[model samples]
Target: MFKGLCRLTSVAALVCSTFSTALGAESGKQVYTGTLGKTPIVLEVNADGGGDVGGRYFYQKYRKDLMLSGKKVGQTLVLDEVPLRGDQDAPHPTIRLQPKPDGWSGEWRSPEGKVLKVDLQQANIAPAPAATVPFLTTLRDQSPYEYLRLQGLDLKKGKAETFMGYSLQWWIEPKSETTLFEVVSGYTAAERQRINQQLMGRLWQEVAGKFDCEASAGETFYAQTVEPLWMGPSTISVSIATEYSCGGAYTDENDMPLNLDVKTGKTLTLEDVLWLGQGKPLHYEREYNDATPSSESYDAYSDYRTKTLAPWLVQQLSALYPDEMKTTTEREDGCIYGDEQPWTYPSWYFTKSGIKLVPSFPHISSMCRDTAFSVLPYNLIQQHPGSAALQLP
Candidate 1:
């Protein structure tokens, strides 16, 4: 399924590139290059074309041999798409580094294949080029989507601007109604709303049944935005601003469901901040609820073994005397039942399938006269020795 979709998406790319390139020009580069730790890694555009992605060497620290394929549309460097070996989803295009008489320069393409013209001819030529200023690249698609409206400024083709003496990049772009008939077909908005309300009511009932609910309410709103970033190989830097609002929340005091502020806004709550501080914690992991589940309820392994495991046994017993194996059917209550049982000595027989057991008694039956046949040894082994048992009875 994924393979088919990927193929379809790739084919779709040919026609989609035009609008995507224009819309894409607004967002910067998706793929990027930088360091993982101390080791330098060339991060490039992935097939999904979202942002900077690392290759196998990103982990092993193997710098790819930057082989120049030639120029694209003149002085523009053309990079070869190297088939990377490692855990990457697909191979990516290499960063084409074009060296002039003075310094190295190149153009970087975002994941979407929209190229960002870059030049570092005048910067200080040290061992390697440093990422002077980052740009607002592309807004990544979280999932498969349509109507991708990338919100931001625009740039012209064949035109160039400088940031810390570098150019900015660019790129671009449920329902149900049915009912049990109507109840199942929720085909209209009203029907869907009714269904959703009923569902939420039932869910709340179940939750309230399990635990006391101090409040109950919900709100719905829509939001979108474009965030900027400075993504190198290993290190990632970015800024985000979102527009959103809470629909509503239910509380016991409001018999008339009070609606929360349904308005859009933005808050920069310290997500894009990272520090290599002194004596500070290397990693400060955080979780939402702000509390941890207690471990005291857990028992030791030995306790579980004695209480839930030890003394449990399974055994198979040989035929008590001898038995007759038969397949028979009967009408029980109203259902027709099939039986596979062994007829034993005296007059009783039993059959079982999985967890069900059956008891039956046949009056002599047609086998009484020929019961003396000597198939006893096989029957004893197979638990079908009714012939041998009938001889005694």
Candidate 2:
């Protein structure tokens, strides 16, 4: 399952192109909007003078970037499209443009010798993506990618779902769909409203990131799903799985779990549920929940994660699932579930049986992630509750 470690999951630019837009500066970069024939396109060009010109362009409909790199000849720019696969020697499309009265007029020639008219004019940058939800950037900072992707989309509502007697309505948008649910019966009316707002905000982040990544790479792969793992008088917990390729070397996936307090609707963190810290656990900053602590405090927290918490998890899970704890070979692609190395930086969620620990591994061993072999029983939580006053079943 895919989750947003909030690993600050980044969407990088491929070649000659980046996730940058024109915003009140002449940083050698300019954004243009026009048409490659009948197809509308957004183009960025950097003419910083060295006779070198580079940028990215995407069809407005597709929203996937096509890298551009070439040279400026007199009054014209001759930009060759770089292969998305990074094969410089491979055949690609080419664009030649000269300054016009309004913007730039160009011709795009395909490798197959087909030619098309390319007309581009300066694009007026729109306001940041505040349309989905108010203060949408609270969960994570907005990027040029977000603005570029969201500016054109008109989100519509999809079907609603009733799960375990709970009503959840789908707020539909692409490159994915998400839901919003109010805890009418489990929590107080006011608290439920607040909790629903928080849930919707988080869902917006997940869905928005999906669209952002999707737009970044025209051929980008993206999918997301949220499953209610456990919903009770204690808390409502859901597992969000996101699998996407956002202009990276390879595709990525993660499982970000959301656990909420029934009474307060407060989103529960690992530190809130199970802290092995000496005194104060990872501090939750003012607004951003994914925000990290300073170096000194973070060093201590790292010690607790790697040295204290991870090893204990190894022991606890080993006693329960001995077979799963073993790793074969990197070549064999065996997931080492018991390896305390990954458990240190805990990725956990509330499960029906217990608190399930999801381990993260490097690219080669990424198959080792989300194995779900390690779950600490709820009875253990009853015995050793963290600083949180909430009760768990």
Candidate 3:
């Protein structure tokens, strides 16, 4: 289940403020979840003493969050979307919902000028299963030093006939009392929002684009950010991993590491994490296991595999596991040890103690081997050349 926060205004406050004479009530917020024209949605409404209304509307289908603001004019409640940055030119949808005895009914207008009849009944607010609901979890909490939150969104289409799906789980740090912490948190939030838009737009274009595939042959895409790593006073880091299968022979997996300077909101690259000399750092492009001959030459791929990253990684791994490497390398099919194969970017994350490296499946050995993780302690890293640049304690 996804866990996150949904800060809503109390229904009592809304009633008393919007219809004080008709229904006397107290103040606060309420959340309602249901469907809007077959799309699952969540609405949070807040009411103030002056009859001002403000809250959030979550379009679960696309995992879009729209800020809402409106007021009760006579017996009608009107709400409109407050767009985010770079969205000013886009049409702003509006909701004209009227309160009913059991729930609310309204009409929703799309930016494209399409209209949909909305029928929403009040229901108990409960966490939906992640497998089914687009956004199943939300969290809003604070610690002495920092506050943390998470939100999850999933989309599934053509499921009845084929199987196309996309999912995103992310963290949201709305505010922080610390200046540097707040800046870095805002940067991360903005980056996540940008990625969400790109991914969603890509998925739609792929599924409905000119080269659309048959519904019987759909694909699946999934991505999620792991638990964040926040320890040092000046650094914060997280990893986002993705897996996709488009009726291919093998599913593809990749990861993006997000390391940030807590003071400047600047992203830290892999080189920043590792102490590299003036020469180029270890880098290699992957060759898919099911690559076609029209792709780049195999010799170039092999050269990168054996000459660049493989040798360096081998030396490090040997230093860390000398005894195991001696016996393991003697065996046939013994860990391709960096050979021509479908390559995935190694996944890495930072911790207070060390930097952890997660080798993808088949990267260290064969598919039979359990995924292996290697940790280079901070002390070891400090011993490397130019390590002083890291300024680690």
* Number of the predicted model whose TM-score against the real structure is largest: 2
TM-scores of the candidates in the order shown = 0.16, 0.68, 0.37
How are the candidates ranked when ordered by lDDT, highest leading? Answer: 2, 3, 1
lDDT for each residue of candidate 3 in 1-393, tens digit (9 for 90 to 100): 111212232221221222212111223555555567778676766777476788666565443356788887776778887764345656688888888875688888877888887776543432322321112121111110000011232132211211112122322222110001112223356553433333322222222211111111334333333334443544555544444444445555555555555444344544456643445443232211122443345555446544554456556766786643444357464654332222223555667667765554542333523334356677776654331144453
Q: Which ten residues in a row have the lowest lDDT in candidate 3?
A: 140-149
Give the residue spans of candidate 2 off by over 4 A: 1-34, 45-54, 71-78, 85-91, 96-141, 154-159, 174-221, 243-253, 261-267, 283-300, 318-335, 361-373, 382-389
Segments in model 1 whose C-alpha atoms lie over 4 Å from true places: 1-162, 174-219, 227-236, 249-280, 284-393
Question: lDDT of each prediction vs. the true structure?
Answer: 0.23, 0.66, 0.44
Arrange candidates, best TM-score first: 2, 3, 1
- Tell me how far the alpha carbon of residue 47 in candidate 2 is from the true structure, in angstroms, after superposition: 6.8
RMSD of 3: 18.1
| Residues 1-393, model 1: lDDT tens digits | 111112122222322322332222223322232333244332322222332222221211222222122234344335554432333445455555565653335655546786654443211111111111001010122201011111111112222323222233322110011010011231344533333232222222222221112111223232222222221111111222122223233211101111111011011111111111223212212221123333432333223223322211000111321222222332223211122122111111111111011222232232231222112232222332211111111
> Compared with the true structure, what per-residue lDDT tens digits does model 2 show for residues 102-200?
589979999899999999876544232322233344322333333444334434566666666666655555446554444444456776665665676
